[model samples]
Target chain A: MQGLFVVFRKELCDHFSSYRFVILFGLIAMVSFITSYMAGVHMKENLEALSKTRFSFLMLFSTPGALFSMVQFVSFFGPLIGLVLGFDSINRERAQGTLIKLVSQPIYRDAVINGKFLAGVATISILLVSIVLVISGFGLALVGVVPGIEEIWRLFIYLIISIFYISLWLGVSILFSILFKSIATSSLASVALWIFLSFFVTLGAEVAANAIAPMDRKKETKPEILIKNTRIKERVSLSSPMVLYSKATEIIINPMRKTTGSIVMMMPMEQILSSRFQNPLPLGQSVIIVFPHMTALIAITLICFAISYLVFIKQEIRT
Target chain B: MDADTIIQTVNLTKRYGKQVAVDDLNLSVKEGEIFGFLGPNGAGKTTTLLMLLGLSQPSEGSASLYGLDPLRKATEVKRLVGYLPENVGFYEDLDAIQSLEYVANLNGINKEEALGKIDKLLELVGLKNDARKKINAFSRGMRQRLGIAEVIIKDPKILFLDEPTLGLDPEGAIWFMDFIASLNRDRKITVLLSSHNLSQVQKISHRVGIMINGKMVADGSMESLAREKFGVGDKEYSLEEIYMEYFQEV
Candidate 1:
């Protein structure tokens, strides 16, 4: 535990002092604050249409009409902050010839990996929380609104889950760092995985579902095949951290969003959801709706961290 | 059971697939002795040093540091061993003091105690003035000097220096050797110096072990190896002449 803290403190300093951290901090802050400004500007246009929720302060971050809401921007690009911060964590040290000397110290190998991981997660959490508070402040200044206590509580949960999402990506990049000896190779692998998971996965899933179970309105398609196709596509999309993050954050930030998947399948026929915009679910129930997505993100993060730890301990530094 | 023997290896062999890196070897260094580990490029000096440090596992046999097996009790072994790898580096952004403080902290030394020791070490290594300078601005010789201070940070009983003088200029090399000799003489720190440079090893080492083709071809005092290779005559031979005497073939 002592060694872990020592490593963690040193690594935290490295992250903050690095240009990578500065660039990531600037990029996220700029995008998030800009999205909040845009969302606040557009919220006035659809004030009456939004319905019932007088305290829709969350909408300042989740604007429906904008090309990109702040929340959406975060859900999309936030993982890159993690990827960039951690892509070269191990390999860069190996390349610079510091790992050998580091491991030679009277410290266990596990502490090295654990300390780096904890430090990365902590840095990301701090950055995200500050950005969240900044966006909230923008909403109040631009749109003449302050979030209710309940909205603030929900936003806090949103921040926690987003950190989890980013941690998973951080774990992945660190694992790549351990697997590849060269910093360039590890970074390339991390970026390639990021692009595939964040953007192309959704497109690829849809194409794959179409091939597996074609959907044609012109010819009457079987209901089972259509359901199968949708299920396969959903399964593929769920593998991506972006999809998981987007799903969980959507419900957390927007109270009116009831279910993550099809509302028809989840609700029975007798308990009919009204055709009108339904009353928003309570904060607790909203969290219940996204609990599975949160669990999946955390699970993947732990699994990746564990694999990196084991591989690191087994690897020969001299080679 | 000899208390004077600080490092002992019995039939230590490291093989990678069909190629062997270090063949079965039996070697030992007495406490406070400077043992020069001389070998050609592929003779596995680095590999042997790594196994002794518990950084690599041997394919056969075993090694012990002060009677503790490195592979079995690495933390205990590491606590008493300080290693200076070839071309060592520090965090480029950190100054010499910060880097040394980090190393001290890693070895569980408190800052209060480490501060005084770090100062003394920097002065000894001729890096006291550059203690505030970042490692990025340091020349290769300076990093090597810093590397020495880092190696002795914990006051370890044994020192494993692999190619310690590889990049230093002649004057810098002499300075480094003098420092090592002082540490060995005053502090009784056992030194295992591995290098392909035979002359540098000849200058500081109390004994020499020559490795060729993954096996020890010669192991004894310089006089014994010289007398054996150059034939029993009252003659002084440089390490290069003795080296050619054995490796004159392929």
Candidate 2:
């Protein structure tokens, strides 16, 4: 434990002092601030246009439209931050020749990798939570409204789940970083994976699924038919983190309220509460749902760490 | 070869496909002796040192440090040995002091004691004035000096230095040799130094092992090896000449 802490301190200090962390924080802050400003503008317009109507503040909760906008922005930006922080974690050490010095110490090889992974996760968490707090504060101040207890609880849950989601990507990036020897190669590999997961994978899945289950060629598809098809497409695409996060956002932004004549429309208040967006599952079930993602994150991180440890242990310190 | 042997290797071998890096080597170093391991660039000097330090595994045979198996007890051996790699580096953004302190912490030194030792080591290496400067801004000599300080921070029982003065100027090289000699003499530290700088090794080492083609062809006191192999009866023989003569025969 003492050795781990010592390594952790050094790793964290390295990140804090290096240009990588500074650039990452600056980039995230810029994007979050821009998104928050846009959200405020849209909220103000909605309130002004609806002031003369009979719609109450409760109507605002029905869609939690502004909060969903923030979620969408975060989902896109969060993984970018994760990839940037993790893509060079190991390759940088190899390039700089610090791995030799580090492995020569009395500490266990496992401790070095564990300490680094924890430090990376901690740095990402700090940056992400700070952004969340800032954007939330800005939203509340601009809207001149305090969320109810339920809404606040849902938002907190959403943030926690988002952390796990981003960590999954970070773990993947670290794995690639360790597998490759050059920083450019590792970075390019991580970015390429990110692009595939974020954009192309879903499109490919859609094309494949449609090919497998072709639509009827004789009849034009109805709106209801399209909406049903879209939902099925969404379920299929949720295999990727980006798509999973989008599904999560859909659940949070639109919750079930009262049963309508046909389509069960969520009530305005229920929408607000749901829009704040707790995990779709109950506490226990949420854990089950998140456990696989968390396990995948942890498993890949350890595998990369183990490979690095083995390599460091066996590598001749020629330079 | 009794209890006083700090390092011992029995038939230690490393091979890359058909090319052997270190072949069937048997060697030992006494507790406080300065043992010089001299070899050509590709003669497997670094491979031998890496195996001895538990950084690399042997394809066959075994090695021990202070009676602890290097392969099985690497962490234990590492705790008692300080290794200075051929071209050592630190986190380039950190200054000399920060880098040393980090190494100290990794070695389980107490924070207060580590700070005191860092100061002493910086002074010992004549790097106190440049302690706060980042390593990226340092000269090759400065980096070498800092590397020396880092390895000696905990005052480990054994010091394995691979080409400690590789890139230094003559003045820096002499300064390093003097410092190494003083450490061996005054502190009784066991030193296993691998270098192609034969003259410097000849000056500071108590015993020298000359390796050629993955074999220790000659191993003894400098004076003894010269007398026995190079016929240094009345005249002194330079290490370069001895090395040339040994290789010429092969």
Top-lDDT candidate index: 1
Residue B143 displacement (Å), model 2: 1.3
- Which ten residues in a row are the worst by lDDT in model 2 chain A? A255-264
- Give candidate 1's error at residue A129 in angstroms: 0.6
Query: TM-score of model 2 relative to the true fold?
Result: 0.86
lDDT of 1 by residue, A1-319 (tens): 8889999999999999889899889987987777777777788666667756655798887884347887788888887888988999998889889999888888887889999999999999999999988877777877777778989888889888888888988999999999998888998999899899889999999999999999997998887787788888888999888999999999998888888875423435423663354677889999998999998888988998999989999999973
Q: lDDT (0-100) at residue A314 of candidate 1?
A: 93
lDDT of 2 by residue, A1-319 (tens): 7778888887787778778779878877876677566656666778767565331222232333534455676677778777876788777887787877887788777677778778877887787788867766776777665665545555566666677667666777777777788888988988898888788878977786566555566897665555555555655675567766655543443333211111323445766765585433333444444454445544554565566556544545443
- Flag regions of model 2 displaced more than 4 Å: A44-68, A216-236, A252-319
Q: Write the per-residue lDDT of candidate 2 for residues B1-250, one digit (tens) a residue.
A: 7778878999999998899999899899998999998888889988888788777889999999999987778789888888888888778878898899889888889989999999998998899899999989999999998988988887788999988989899999999998899988888899999988888988989998888888888888877878877575888888778878778877
Note the clash tally of each candidate: 0, 1
* 10 residues in a row with least lDDT, candidate 1 chain B: B241-250
User: Model 2 clash pairs?
Assistant: A61-A272
